[model samples]
Target: MGFTDDGDIAAYRRRRSVEFKHGRIAMLATMGFMTPEIIGHWPGYLSPSMGLKFADVPNGLAALNVVPSLGWTQIVIYFGLIEYSGGFEDYRSGTPGDYAWKALTSDDPEDKRRRLNVDLANGRLAMVAIMAILFQNGVAGTTGPEMWIPAL
Candidate 1:
């Protein structure tokens, strides 16, 4: 359901490539993900398709509470790693190339489809992390102290 225009396709290709690369990084980070706090809330900002969702952390936390400690830190680390790894240009540039030649001509439609799938999947995971934080903080407007925060 993405734009088929030349410019749109170009953007999609570039974004897809970056996301494919980022997903690898995320997988590595999550390999030993013990707590929701460590992963940080993503809300799938990088992905184009999926919208945001809550995290799966047992003790729910919210945006305001987690943004400073967990969310911002995770964003910094993710971007930092991406930069150190020399994926900054690919991450920043959002353009597609001869996608047909790359996806269909060389690989099959299924192979090309997996690239988009990764984006969607990564987005979902990020949303879940965000939701976990929001839930812990009672972001739905209920009153509660964040478990990770020192209770007064």
Candidate 2:
């Protein structure tokens, strides 16, 4: 008797799946590991004295380190949950779509969506704030591992 049992729900889920997929791809292209150059440049922009020679580093670990530590912790946590807890199965089984449909069909869908968006925005803002604070507190330096890890 849930949302997934409805025909309209299936169509809605399909549309949402496509939309989420495209949006994820676009976001990854701009902000995720897909664009190592951008990631490398972020730390430098935040604190030039970090001495993170991202360009000279043997591998791309510099960029990777900064991203995972700075602001992508939510993504890491989400991925870890999906990975270790088999949440990916839910995704494959259309649970997220069903949930999305249910949310959209709810009596207060607009309010729910607004709250969710605000939460997301707040999380992003918090990440940026953390990165800025870390940089300001002189926590933005490259360890020697960046240079040697690549050779191994």
RMSD of each predicted structure: 12.7, 14.5
**Number of clashes in model 2?**
0
**Stretches of candidate 2 above 4 Å error?**
1-83, 86-107, 139-152
Q: Which candidate is the best by TM-score?
A: 1
lDDT of 1 by residue, 8-96 (tens): 65566666665655555555444323344455544544323333244522333334443335556788899888679854444335322
Instruction: Look at candidate 1 and tell me the lDDT of residue 22.
Output: 51
Task: Assess each prediction's global lDDT (C-alpha) against the native.
Answer: 0.49, 0.46
Q: Write the per-residue lDDT of candidate 2 for residues 88-116, one digit (tens) a residue.
A: 23244643323354543344757765654
* Model 2: pairs clashing at backbone N, Cα or C within 3 Å: none
**Deviation from native of the Cα of residue 111 in model 2, angstroms:** 1.2
What's the TM for model 2?
0.29
